[model samples]
Target: MIPQLIFLIIAIAAIALFTINIRKIIRNINLGRPEDRSDRPAERFMVMLKVAFGQTKMTKRPVAAVLHFFVYVGFIIINLEVLEIIIDGLFGTHRIFASPLGGLYNVLIGSFEILAALVLIGVIAFYARRNFLRLKRFTGVEMTKWPLSDANNILIIETLLMIAFLTMNAADYRLQQLGAQHYITAGSFPVSSLIAPLLPNSESALILIERAAWWFHIIGILAFLNYLPYSKHFHIIMAFPNTYYSNLEPKGEFSNMASVTNEVKAMLDPTFTPEPVAEGGKFGAKDVTDLSWKNLMEAYTCTECGRCTSVCPANITGKLLSPRKIMMDTRDRMEEIGRNIDKHGKDFKDERSLLNDYITQEEIWACTTCNACTEACPINIDPLAIIVELRRYSVMEDAQAPSSLNNMFGNTENNGAPWKYSPSDRFNWAND
Candidate 1:
């Protein structure tokens, strides 16, 4: 009865957490963000499938990718074993996995255990690279906020999972030694075989140990479930929708702004107005709210894996713009605005003041509009688009442009290109 109660409580809590978080995630996704339409339907689907299932990002580092792939597959398949364990605990049955397909179940369980061992080895290597090797390119100028804490948490979770695996096997072996049904403990689990000789030949002790292992295993799973949303594991849930709604077009597409008359009318109107659609009103994002929902989603889905920053040409050449940090800033700003809107109303203005006070104009202008950041992003986050939009707003609307940009614009407007040479020069060399 106590075990049933414990199961019920944990199950209820897990369902509640999953429901609430999923609702928030879905609502955010449905916000109708703009996306580029340049990609063919088939191409877009292929890219999504490749990134989501093939794990293209993980493969960037070959060894780490292989290790992670096994662990991911094991974790996904182990849910079935978890369910079986729970059912057996509640029903006092040891023959649940002894049906016609019992052999298949055993095979899966065995495979998961082997993969789990490999994952542990991989995580150990990751820890060494982060802590001891301390690669300058990975760490960046600003230290990661939770470097030590993140490492500790990852280690602890892996260690506890390994212990749970061992304990389950050990208790099963002891049960077999006490003459429990052969179906319950048939052919030895590798880890359990090592411990069989150490247990006393006492049936009562076997039962107690089995019950204790059940409790420990369930508790560890529940703890992990509860902690998932608040940790880096948050990506596990975010990755699905992030991949589903990712931009499917050419990376250079920016949302065209509405015409001036429509924008001015909306600004002057007292009643709330929809976004303008007139031609040439403005050509890019002026503020955070001006960004499409897809862009906003990009901000939230970022794993802060530093993959974008590591490949950024600017960062490699000692520039101030780290594409990873830019995405982080956008997310942080959106969250702040969300809080303010929640406190006030949708009509709540003064968003520009908040953004200007936080993000600097210099930082905004330093961007070279190079697409390196977008090319490097595993999740297809286009930081270059966001930067370009900001530049358009600063120059056209605010009448503020850096000296270099101003000179380039002048050349383009007057001569159609930034080059000083004349187009007629091409014919000079073609004379017969």
Candidate 2:
């Protein structure tokens, strides 16, 4: 009973900390301007199902897709066993679902065991692929510090957790064989049976091992939950909503500035009026708050896989424009702002902006507006949107642009097209 009480307290504390962590992230994401993503419920749902849940986009690389699918599926299904663990821990019961679930419980436990082995294999393969083989995508300009360490840490933690789970089952199975008190013949253990013989034959050692492993598994999961917001592993939960709220427009379509579009409409129709900007509001995104909420969510949703960066033509051409870097920079800037708000007030100004501080003008300008980065993202994150927003801020608010683009804008204003010829020369080309 005392053990049960301790488990209950730990569980409650973990839940409270996780809630606080999630709320902080939600608030940070909300700092961005709001845009309606509630339209087309059916289409959004289908997109979420296909991209986020089905992982269709991840199939671009079959090897990774297969490996990641094992880990993803295992993570979901094996957690069902954790439900039984929680019940047992709370009620001081052993194999609480064994009788109610009966033979089906055996099948489920066996399947989880197989999945555990698969997850172990997948994690090992991934770690090897990242470190040993040295995949180019896994190592980039941003992969040196926390980004690199974060990925490896999650991999190691997952490996340890899976090992602990299997070790607990192995010790439990051996004890059940010994006809030990409270250790009944319950769920099947196919994979762990192999490990059973390798374990020490002493009942006391086996019991201690089983209890320790059980505690380690549960505690590790709780710790992982709290660590997610600070790590790239947050994508495991953020991907669904990020995919669902992702832009559904055609690739070639670019959203027009609402301020300019409304002004044009007001000129064409008497009843139309342009919406006024709030005081000190700029034309484009100079900081995280200027982007749409979806953009900010995409920032946090990014797991730094570098899939977007690998396919970027600009980066391929030796440009500094890494889409992965853009998202990481935006996420970092957002967190900085969130911390500032927490320490000071929401209205507190930090002379630093995401545009020049985190992301560079050179990096943003190098992009060709080609949607390749958007297509390559596994969870449907639109880093291209953030890039465009930054470009807009530069070109509009600061009136800063490359000389070539400035010339193009000038030509368009004078000649009705992006050409050096005047409007009077429009008919001269026909004669030529």
Candidate 3:
């Protein structure tokens, strides 16, 4: 009774903490301006099913994809064992499902053991790729110290958790073979049976090992759950929603702000009446809040995979821009703003904007308005949209642009083209 009560308390506490952190993240995501992505419900659902659930984009790298698919499937399917553990822990029962399901339980356990072993292999391969083999995409500038350490930490945690699960099974199987009380001779252990012989056969020692492994696996899962909010692994939860809310418009089409579009329409149509502009109104995104809520959500959903940067034309040509860096910077700035809001009030104003503080003008302008970053992102994160907004702010609000851009803007205004010539002279070049 006491053991059941203790386990229940700990489980409830972990759940409460996880729920609170999830709420805080949602609150931060809501801090951005409103966006309507409510259109095309059926299409969005299919996209989510394909991209997030199916992992279609991840298959672009077949070798890594196969390993990742095993790890992902194992992580999800192995949780059935966790369900059994939870039930056993709550009721102080031993292998509760084994007696009821009989042969099926044995098959399930056998399959879980095989998957757990495969998960271990996959995680080891991932660790080797990141640390030893040093995959260029995983070792880029944005993947410096903390990001690298975080990736390694997750892989290590996964490896340890799988080991704990198998070790617990091995210990339990050994105890069952010894005809120990409450140790049912039920579920089959294909992989753990191989491990069981290596373990000491002492009854007391086996009990200790089983209990310790059980505790380690459950406690590690709880710790990992809370850690997701802080780590890039949070995408495991956010990816579905992010993919569903992805921009489905033409890749080359830029979304002009509603206010800016109305202003432009007013000028074009003399009969159109524009809303009165408030003095000192800002244009484009000057801070995190100026961006749409979907833009902010993209930051939370970023896996930091560097696929966007790997295929980026600017990065390929040795320019100062990295789309991965742009996403990371946006996320960092959003986090800073969230922290400030927590300390102050919801309407708290920060002196630092995302433009000069987090991302530089050089990086923004280096982009050729190409959608390569969008195309390469497995989760459909649009880093170019953020870049375009920042660029608009620099040109319109700050009135600060490169000399070449200024000349081009002047030519467009006067000659209706990007060349410094009269409209009649456009035909003169053809005549020459």
Candidate 4:
């Protein structure tokens, strides 16, 4: 009963902490401007299903897709065992489901064991790809010491967790063979049977191993749950809604602000009067708060895989614009602001912002608006959208576009084309 009481307390505390962390993230995401993405429910659901759940985009890289599929699917399926663990922790019962399920329980246990093995193998491959194989996608200026260490830490934690699970099963099976009290003779253990031989024959030693492993596994899972929000693995939870709220319009189509649309309308038609925009309204995003909630959500959803950066034409051509860095910077800045709000209250003012402070004007301008980054993102993270927003802020609000772009904008306005000559003189170039 004392053990059960302690488990209950720890479980409650872990869950509460996880809830608080998630709520903080939600608050940070909500700090962004609201843009309605609630239209087309069925289409959004399909997008989430295909991109987030099916992981269709990842299929382009077959090897990576298969390995990630094992980790993703295996983790989710194996966590079903957590349910049994929770039940046993609460009631002081062992193999609680084995009695009623009978042979089906054995099938379930066998499947879980197989998945755990696959997950372990997948983790090893992933670690090798990052550290040993030195994959290009995992190497970049953005892949700093912390990012590398964080990735490795999660991999090591997962490997240990899986080993602990298997070890627990092995020791439990050994106890069952010894006909120990409170050790149920249920569930098949194909993987653990081989491991059982290595465990101690003494009942006290076996019980200690089994109990220790069980405690470690559950405690590790609770720790991992809270750690998700701080790591790139937050994508595991953010991917769903992030993909669901995906921009459904054509990649090339830029979404216009309502006031800007009104101004454009008045320019083309004398009878159409433009509505007055609010005095404090800004032209474009200058910070995380100026961005749409979807953009902020995409920031949090980033896996930091660098696939987007690897495919970026600007980055490939030696420009300093890394799409992965853009998302990481946004997330980092947002988290900082969240902490500020927590400390000083929401009304506190700060001069720092996501634009020039985290991402520079040079980086924003390097973007080609090609959407290649968006295409490469596994979960539909639109890094180009953030770049566009920053560019808009620079050009419109600050009037700080590069000379070439300013020249083009001037020519387009004057001659109805992006050239030095007038519309009537366009044929003169042909004549030349």
lDDT of 4 by residue, 1-432 (tens): 999999999999999999999999999999988888999999999999999999999998999999999999889999989999999999999989999999999999988888888999999999999989999989888888888998998999999999999999999999998999999888788888888999989999999999999999999999999889899988999999999999999999998778788878998998998778652378788999999888999999998989899999999999989999999999999999999999999987799999989999989988888898999999999999898889888998999899999999999999999978879977776776
Model 1 segments more than 4 A misplaced: 28-43, 89-95, 141-143, 180-183, 186-188, 195-213, 252-283, 341-359, 419-432
The models' CA-based lDDT, in order, is: 0.65, 0.92, 0.89, 0.92
Ranking by lDDT: 2, 4, 3, 1
Alpha-carbon deviation at 61 in model 3, angstroms? 0.8
Each model's TM-score, in the order given? 0.80, 0.97, 0.96, 0.97
Candidate 1 RMSD to the real structure: 5.3
Clashes of 2: 0
The parts of candidate 2 lying over 4 Å away from their true place are 265-280, 427-432
The 10 consecutive residues of candidate 4 with the worst lDDT sum are 274-283
Candidate no. 3 TM-score: 0.96
- Runs of candidate 3 exceeding 4 Å displacement: 275-281, 427-432
Q: State the weakest 10-residue window (summed lDDT) of model 3.
A: 275-284
- Model 1 TM-score relative to the real fold: 0.80
Q: How many clashing residue pairs appear in each of the predictions shown?
A: 5, 0, 0, 0
lDDT of 2 at 128: 96
